[model samples]
Target: MSTSASQQADLDPASFRAIADLAYRESGLTLVQEKSSMIQSRLRHRLRDLGLADFAAYCSLVQSDAGQGERRNLISALTTNVSHFFRESHHFDVLRAELDRHLPKLRAGGQLRIWSAGCSNGQEALSAAMTLLDHVPDVARLDLRILATDIDPEVVQFARKATYPERLVRGISPDMLKKYFDQTTEAGHEPSYIAKPVLTDVIRVNELNLLSPWPMRKRFDIIFCRNVVIYFDQRTQEKLWPSFLNALAPDGVLLLGHSERIAEPERYGFTCTGPTTYRPCHALKSTARPEKQKQSEG
Candidate 1:
């Protein structure tokens, strides 16, 4: 392609918005209006690599499924899966507290299950693993498993790798860092950081599309779907709440993003324990037959 033609391949705001809308409808994410700049920065290289003139044609190719494997690549490229270790610190604090309070009842058969929805690049999963180790004795001996999932397959692959640079480990507690991370150097940089054996104990990284059916039929003790629902419109959030509730065990705890909360918590049978945290009503079993039970004598 000519230089001029190559330069023309970059996705413009309108074209990006169109493709984003299509992806959002397919996936139930609402890319913030301000993300246009970030989107352009990220996709410019993809457009050039594909030799497509501007985003409109690229989007057309994506929508048409023109190539054998471009559609999935396109979806993966457009989706944002930004996250860091201990990204939202408060949620982890709450998580530790909840685990301490409920660990005994949940420790049946020496097993406990957790899920980190939208777990980008496995930091949160590693954090969960580290946190579990801190609170539970012989943590490696416990049958603890965490399911880390994201819609973006590329990120899932990266999560499987479980490597990170020093910058990504910022704000992580010093003791946890020394204990869980293996230091290494980058190609030209002096600093290097990566996950140690601690990650292997707790995280199970896999691909999962939140808008679609979850493969895990089993309920979880703690489900962390943080900073994920903010991208979805309220309607989408409303739809997802019930599905999340169904995925939870009777006493399961649900953690949402700091800014995200259901306006009608009662509809989902969630009781607010703190800001942005909820507990599935332990008394209201999903299978209970209220009408069939007789009242006791007064």
Candidate 2:
């Protein structure tokens, strides 16, 4: 009564929905119903690679402790990391304004720290650096830095290399294009944009998974978790919001995707501003009065 390869390929809709739910819980992303075909297509490759003809057997492999590598592969396959330089323009604009507004007031020992929680490539982080360098004076002397991270090892490596197809440079400003990048041909054919010295001022890319406990104990002045959160389910979003709040400094600001907003910022001590930005509410220090402490003495 074992299912055939074709039978397994035709796994019931329920199974697909279950996989989607698991993915949402694990990665904070949703696989739309239309993506069943996409799931089947991609998982089929994993099935073949694992030598499992049936989807049930593949699912079993993914669930088993011995199959942890396969599970990661499944996650990598499902998560889409399509990001570009200045993909959402207003956010960067806000970043520039914030830098202009905050740079001079920062304490001597305090540095400007920003996190691009799901930075796919290095573009967003680089863009942030460029903004700071352009707007803030002596940015290098200011102890400013960006921590950019992504779940995918492939993209992380790409970010490390900091190379991209020449066509990807369309949106980059001409002045920045010339100042920060070197245009060169690699392997004697394709054009590549390589990072120059200016980029050294801005970003440090890391391999990070947002759903997992953050390795960073310190807080960031600003965190950009845009577009990425929308993929997560409401429950996961609820859990993540508090973690993000905790990761922010007393006056830290969080910039979320334009389409996303916290349902209850007051619960997390986050006060909403505009559509999708949040600031940590500064807690007033309370000192107990002697009279109040002795209220029952009378």
Q: Write the per-residue lDDT of candidate 1 for residues 129-236, one digit (tens) a residue.
A: 887787774656657789999988898998887777777788688888888788887688768677777666578888887988888978887899988888889899
How close is every model to the real structure, measured as TM-score? 0.85, 0.84
**Tens-place lDDT digits, model 2, residues 1-298:** 2234543575457768767766776677788888788788767767766667666776776667887787678888887777888777767766776676566665365588899988887777877877777776477676687899988777788888888887777778889888878988878668988877667556888888898889987789889998888877788788888899899877677888767878877787776654466777562222111111111110
How many residue pairs of model 2 clash at the backbone? Answer: 1
Question: How much RMSD separates candidate 2 from the native structure?
Answer: 8.4
Error in Å for residue 255 of model 1: 0.5
Stretches of model 1 off by over 4 angstroms after superposition: 2-4, 7-14, 32-37, 105-110, 186-190, 282-298
